[model samples]
Structure formats: C-alpha cells, structure tokens
Target: MGTKRLKKQWLLHAVGGLLMTGLGLSLFGEALIKKWENAPLWDWLLWGTLALLVFNAGVSLVGQAVVFRVKLDGRNEK
Candidate 1:
C-alpha cells in the first residue's frame, strides 16, 4: 500500500483498538462490581476480543514504523 493509505489504516486500527479496549474495560469492571452471575463468560469473551484488537493494532503500527524506517535508511544511504 502507499504511504498515505498505510498511515490511514494504521490510524484507524489504533483508534479502534483504543475504543474497544476502553469499552471492554468498562464492561468488565461493571460486571465485577455489580456481581452479575452470568457476566463471567461474557467478561472473558470481551477481554479476549479486546486483547486481539490491541495486539493487531500494535503489530500493524510497529510493522508500518519498521517499513518506514527502512525506507528512510535506504534513502539516506544512497
């Protein structure tokens, strides 16, 4: 992908990850404090989903950074 597209994609992923993480934390916290008997399963599911989103976001950002850095390094070497 082009640099701009890649950057946009990274931004989207990062934002989505942050939003999901926040929602998951809020839900999980509410469930814990409220002592809902049926919440345990849903809590675990939300956490797992949040973890995946954050992981994917982190990997995408890191990958883009490394690619950009390599490009810059190559340009400087020439």
Candidate 2:
C-alpha cells in the first residue's frame, strides 16, 4: 500500500479510537450515576461492562495507530 493510504488509515484509526473512548467514558459515567437513583443491579453491570469494552477497544485502536506512525517514520528516515 502507498504511504498516503497508510497515513489516512492511521488518522482514521486515531480519530475512531478517540471517539470510542469518549463515548465509552460518557456511557460509563451515566451508568455510575444511576447508582444514586437506585437503578437495577443488572443495569449497572451491563452498562459498565459495555462501556469498559468500548474503552478498551478504542485504546487498542489508538495503539495500532501509534505503531503505524512509528513504522512510517522509520521508513521516512531511510
């Protein structure tokens, strides 16, 4: 694949990761706040778990983007 294409993919990965992390955090917060309102135990667990998964996925994506960036930089140095 071309360098430009790789850069675009890297950018997409970074942006997607950031958005996923933000959304997950927001959801997690909402789930936590539900405790004060006497929400069901299962509801809390479900939302909290889902949010964590999303957050983890986002972090992984961001990590991949960093790897791509590092490899690209190395190539540029040659």
Candidate 3:
C-alpha cells in the first residue's frame, strides 16, 4: 500500500478499535460496578472504558491483519 493508503488504514483501525471498546464498556458498565465493593462510580467507569479500549485495540489489530492478508492474496492472484 502507498503511504497515504497505509495511513488511512491505520486511522480506520484506530477508529474501529475505539468504537468497539466504547461500546463494550458502555454496555457492561452497570454490571461491573455492581460486582465491586466501595468502588466509586467514576472509577468503575474509567476501568470499564480502559478494558473496552484494550479489547477493541486487539480486535482492530486482528481486523487489520485480516484485511492485509486478503489484499495480499488478491494481488497474488493477478
């Protein structure tokens, strides 16, 4: 890929990761808070968000890998 395309891909990967992480944390926020004791609400929120971000980062990286693999395969077929 060209530098511009590569940068775009990276940006997409980042955006996708952020989306998934935020979604995961938001969906599970309440449950997480209930499971812990003496935990401030903001603390739970922060932890949940971090966990989601980490999860998303991993998933997005995998997604980027798959995308590159597919592109490579297509190029080889030509």
Candidate 4:
C-alpha cells in the first residue's frame, strides 16, 4: 500500500465543502417545506436552483481535495 499525504489547504477545502453541503441540504429542505406553505413558484425555483448549485460546488470542492497531486516512493529518498 502507498502512504497517504495531505496538505493544510486541502483541509480547508474539505471543511468548507462539508459546511456548504450541509447548508445546501438545509436550504433544499426548507424549499421543499415551503410547498406545504403554498410558496410562490418563483421562490421555489430560486431556492431550489441555488441549493443545487451550492451542493454541486461543495461536491466539486470535495472532489478537488481527493484529486490532489502526490509523489510516490523512491526518487526523493536519501
């Protein structure tokens, strides 16, 4: 198995992504709940699209964190 290496910046991306994901989900749930309250179609469309965009951005960030570059064993060794 290969060793795993991570950078501090990546941690920020991961944490931010998690927060964004949670926020997006909350927004989405709120939007859904609005249906029972008879919210306007425009309101639903706005919030729903915003929620999806945020969720997708979060997922993209998380994917970026996972795709970071790393060096394998050998050349750098003394």
TM-score, model 3 to reference:
0.49
Best of the candidates, lDDT? 2
Which 10 consecutive positions of candidate 2 have the poorest summed lDDT?
67-76
lDDT sort, best first: 2, 4, 3, 1
Count of clashes, each model: 0, 0, 0, 0
Residue-level lDDT for 17 in candidate 1: 55
Best-performing candidate as measured by TM-score: 2
TM-score quality measure for candidate 1: 0.50
For 11-67, candidate 2 gives per-residue lDDT tens digits of 999999999999899889988988667899998888899999999999999998998
TM-scores of all candidate predictions against the true structure: 0.50, 0.92, 0.49, 0.76
> Over 4 Å off in model 3, which ranges?
2-35
**Model 2 misplacement above 4 A:** none
| Candidate 3 weakest ten by summed lDDT | 26-35
lDDT to native, each model: 0.59, 0.89, 0.66, 0.73
Question: Which digits, one per residue and each the tens of the lDDT, describe model 1 over residues 1-78?
Answer: 555665566566556556655665565565555445555776756655655665565556556656665665565578
Clashing pairs in 2: none
List where candidate 1 sits over 4 angstroms from the true fold.
1-39
Identify the superior model by TM-score, candidate 1 or candidate 2.
2
